[model samples]
Target: PKRKTVEKHGRDLRDIIGQQQGKRALEIAAAGNHNLLFLGPPGTGKTMLASRLCDLLPEMSDEEAMETASVASLTQSEINEHNWKSRPFRSPHHSSSMAALVGGGSVPRPGEISLAHNGLLFLDEMPELDRKVLDSLREPLESGEIIISRAQGKTRFPARFQLVGALNPSPTGYYEGNQARTNPQAILRYLGRLSGPLLDRFD
Candidate 1:
């Protein structure tokens, strides 16, 4: 049987206007495989910049492709020639459960972090996510894998992927100078959803 293939298209860094610092940060993070966090107001092109990191990354090696494919296969996700060598990009919603984000089930399945192995995981609206859910990423981020324990046994899934997070500086999405809509305490409370340890994981 002939293998089917599909083309993978991603946003280009060139399409984004200005944000020179953001672009440079993406480039550095891509080059070093470091985690990144973008803190700014809405409409600042944070997500747009994060989307371009995968485009900046190099093609996956054969081993990397196989590892990624194996995880996808477990999830029954489609794999094709075009994406076989390309890095993955996973963006889960803030409301996602810990199990959903970190992988869980009676049978144990790969979660967003595992699916993003050898690629990038973009967490938009970072501060909006549950503190516990966000904290769950700490271990995997450092260990490069997640161990999901079950009554039957423990299943380990590769999760060595760059983490790119985006969030507004304040709850109202305005925090600079006179444009700030909320009090400093309120902003602190909003940003407080992300733990200190989790923030330490990023570059």
Candidate 2:
């Protein structure tokens, strides 16, 4: 089953249209387990390309598969029959809170990053995410783990996965034209959501 899944992913990857540079970057990220940020205007294939990283990634070993499954179980994320060993790919909406991304609640549950253990966490529209929410990922990205503390207790979730972030170049989602919609100051403010320390974590 795992072999078939990997073959199917490879076939899907071959069908992606002309994205030599993006493909190359994905290959490197998959090979080295590095974090990457793709900056461009909307409609650029950033999301599509980021989603294809699973194709190049190797299959999870039994221990990894079990650990990943445990996180999913903790989060109550549905695990289909054939997807138990498949690599996880989590992409939360831009409005997600720090708790949603890093994991927190009255009882504490695995968030997107933890659910993506031994897999990929793709953050599309990176700049649209709140500054604090974005900053919350820095620690996990560095330690390959996340700790959610609640009134009950502290819950630790595995977050060792490659991060693929996609964002526009500016506030207006374009740099070439539409000057009336955005200015240098607006662009600075928009990009400021991604703090310097957080940005430093990406490769």
Give the alpha carbon lDDT tens digit for every residue of 1-203 in model 1: 99966454767678887889999998899888889999988888888888899989888899999999999999887886656899988999989998889999998998999999999999999988888889989999999999999999999999998999999989889877677868889998999889999989988
Cα deviation at 168, candidate 2, in Å, is 0.4
Tens-place lDDT per residue, model 2, 1-203, is 45533333334467788989998888888888889999988888899898888867877888999999888888678875565667888999999988888888887887899988999999999988988888888888889899888777788888998889999988778878654378788888888889899889888
Model 1 misplaced stretches (Cα beyond 4 Å): 1-9, 176-179
Residue 128, candidate 2: Cα error in Å is 1.0
Q: Which ten residues in a row have the lowest lDDT in candidate 2?
A: 3-12
How many Å off is the CA of 200 in candidate 2?
A: 1.3
Q: Score each candidate by Cα lDDT.
A: 0.89, 0.85
Deviating ranges (above 4 Å) for candidate 2 = 1-11
Q: Give the clashing residue pairs of candidate 1, or none.
A: none
Q: After superposition, how far is residue 30 of candidate 1 from its true place, in Å?
A: 1.2
| RMSD from true fold, candidate 2 | 2.6
Tell me the deviation in Å of residue 112 in model 1.
0.5
